[model samples]
Target: MNDEKIVQRAIEGDDTAFLNLIQLYKIDLYKTGYSFLKNEEDVLEAIQEVTYRAYKNIRNVREASYFKTWLIRIMINYCNDQLKKKNRVVLGEEVLNFQGSADNYFAMEIQEAMLTLDDRSREILTLKYFHDLKIKDIADSMKRPEGTVKTWLNKALKSLREKLEEKGGKVNV
Candidate 1:
């Protein structure tokens, strides 16, 4: 079934429907949580919490077609809450593993530079690149305007590049 149908089923108290929904979105939700928490344990916890919350609040979801976006936003909020609870400071790319060639090193450097940015900038870059979300989707997920999301993305990329360059990291022209 489609997302709408699955969501309707879930809202009607179908356990299998909710399970299917979780199965479909688990990876994306985990990745979204990882982007914010930057720790495996925290990601796991946030995912669990988000899954529970989503299941519990399935009936409250008005727009069934927007299930993915809605779930992602919930994951984001859950990750933020986890961050607050832990009071952890995640600087640099604590999540990415650099196990490739010289180019990979630079990519890691870029990720580290990205981590130097504020939470909003880092989130914009993560959602744009890692999740490959569109400008409007990001704006909606982040509750920001399209133009504002574009502006933030531009500034974040420029800042990340500058930081990488400052760290003697070179990106291929």
Candidate 2:
């Protein structure tokens, strides 16, 4: 179903519809939260709060077609609020011990390198890479101009490449 239909169902107190929407976006939301807080527990809490707030204030959301962006904005705000409440602590390096595949190693390394970036850079990378958002969508989600998003994206990629290169791994654009 279209997001508007789903949201319309949800607005009428359809818990199932709301839950379905949450399920659809939960992983993406959690990963975005994790990118910011780098804590599984904090990510979970933020996701929970985002869902509650979305449900409680569903009436305030003006348009259903914009639900995904609206939800992401809510998640970002919740994560930021949580960060303010408790300053972020650096997370330990992600372990690649689960699978010895080269892809796993590279993913862990990238995650570690991403951790080193400033929050905005990290978020841009996460939105672009992990969430698979288009540059335009990312700009809208971030409330930044398209040109600014492009600039930040280029700078962020360069920063990440340098960091990876220093670790003896190169990021080829």
Candidate 3:
């Protein structure tokens, strides 16, 4: 079934539909959680918490079309709360462990540069690039104006470029 249909079913208190919905997005949720939390255990914990919260509050989601965005917002908020509790700051070498092919290494280098940014900048970059979310969806998920989201996205790209240049990497942007 389509996500919207499944979401509608879930909102109607179909336990199986909710479980199916969670299963469908499990990998995305795991990856999103892992981006904030490098540890496997913590990522798993965040996913579990997000799942429970989403299931309990499924009815609160107004639009079935935005189910994924709503779930991601919850996960992001949960991850932020976890970060606050641990007072964790994502350092380059600690978070981006680059061990693989040369292409993967370069990608990891960019990720390391991204780690230098503030949480909000990193988040916008992730949503735009990694998750491939459009500006409108990002703005909605963040509860910010589209213009604000655009400004933040530009700032994030600029900051990423600066960081990359500082590390002697050539940044086109």
Candidate 4:
């Protein structure tokens, strides 16, 4: 069955269908969590929490077709909460391993710039660029108009560019 059908079954409290939906989007959830938490342990915790939250509130899903986006938003919100609680960046071995790379400097700059952005701007940029989501998908997930999303994306890119330029010469993030 297609995702929407599976989502519908899950909403109807079908255990197998719910598990299938989680399995289908597990990687996306992991990547989304990892992008924010930047720690495997934290990502795993986030996954568990998101699963519970999704299950508890599955009935609140407004559109079955946008289940992936809804799931991702849950992960993002959980990750953000964890970040707020921690209130500091924790470097993992994954980042340490890249310390010797030539492009690491630029990568670090981009990360720093991303951190400076407001939450909504950062979210729009992440969903648009990192997740490669379409404008319509992001707008639907954010419950904002497409034009508003596009405007936010544009402003985010401009802010990111300015931050990168401040760090060094003009460079694309």
Candidate 5:
């Protein structure tokens, strides 16, 4: 079944449909959690918490088409809260994981640069590049205008470039 139908059924309090929705997006939830937590245990905790939250709030989804984005937002909000509660610092392993073919030095530089980004900028970059989400989807998920998202993406790339340059690393963002 399509995600929209599954989401519709889930919203109607269909347990199986909800489970199916969770199963379909589990990997996405995991990856998003890991990006923030950088710890398997914490990611697992986030996943559990997010699953509960998603199930509890499935009916709140504004549109069936945005179900995936809505689900991801729940994960993101949970992860952000956990990070705030724990006062954790996000690091570079996620960047290395995403850039498999890059050398350690390049990856390290990229990671360091990434660490300096503000939450919004980092989110834009990660959602746009790491997760391969389109600009429109990101805008929808973020509840921002598409032009705003594009502007943020551009600014984020520029910031990333400047940070890399400051470290004497190559600029390819």
Candidate 6:
């Protein structure tokens, strides 16, 4: 079934359709959660919370076509809330260790740099680059104006560039 139809069915209280929708987007949601969270356990917890919240509030999603974005927004919010509850910032070492891959030096540097950004900046960058979301969709998911999203995107890129440069990595801003 098409995503829109599946979402519609989910909104109409079809349990199987809801499970299907979650299965379709599980990897994306997990990756999004991992981007902010420190450990696999935390990421899994965040995903569980997001799933529960999405299931309960599926009816609030106004557009079937935007179900993915809506689901991601919920995941992001839940991850943020978890972070706040922990009241601890994850160090770069911990984040890097979580991946446990030493083969990609460049990716490691980029991930380290991303860890330096504030939550909003990192979120904008993640949505734009990792999720490959359009500006309009990002703005909608973030509940911000397009112009503001643009500004934040630019600032995030600039900050990422500076951090990369500081670590002797070259990236075009």
Find the candidate with the highest lDDT and give its number: 4
* Cα lDDT, all candidates: 0.78, 0.79, 0.83, 0.86, 0.82, 0.85
Lowest-sum lDDT 10-residue window in model 5 = 92-101
Query: Candidate 6: what lDDT?
Result: 0.85
Please say which candidate is ahead in TM-score: 2 or 6. 6
Would you list the clashing residue pairs of candidate 3?
A: none
In the range 37-124, model 3's lDDT, one tens digit per residue, is 7678888999999999999899999889889888887887887788778775654354356467767766666866765678799788
lDDT tens readout by residue for model 1, 35-152: 6667787788888889999988888787777778788878877766666676656643433454667766765566556656777777778778877789998887667899999999
Question: Residue 23 deviation, candidate 5, in Å?
Answer: 0.8
Q: Residue 41 lDDT in model 4?
A: 91
- By lDDT, highest first, what's the ranking? 4, 6, 3, 5, 2, 1
Which regions in candidate 4 have their CA more than 4 angstroms from the true location? Answer: none
- Off-target runs (Cα >4 Å) in candidate 6 are 91-103
Clashing pairs in 5: none
User: Model 4 over residues 1-173: C-alpha lDDT tens digits?
Assistant: 78999999999999899999999999999988877777899899899999999999999998999999899889988877887788876565666777566588676667767777777887888888878899999998998899999999999999999988987796755
Candidate 2 worst ten-residue window by lDDT: 89-98
lDDT of 4 at 159: 95
Backbone clashes counted, model 3: 0
* lDDT by residue for model 6 (1-173), tens: 68999999999999999999999999999998887775788889888889999999999998898899899888877877777787776643554455656555667777778877888898888888989999999998778899999999999999999999998856776
- Worst-scoring 10-residue span by lDDT in model 3: 89-98
Candidate 1 lDDT (Cα, 0 to 1): 0.78
Q: What is the alpha-carbon RMSD of candidate 5 to the true structure?
A: 3.2
Residue range 81-120, candidate 2, lDDT tens digits: 6766766545533562346788877776777788677767
User: Of 1 and 4, which scores higher on lDDT?
Assistant: 4
After TM-score superposition, the amount by which residue 97's alpha carbon in candidate 3 deviates from its true location, in angstroms, is: 7.3
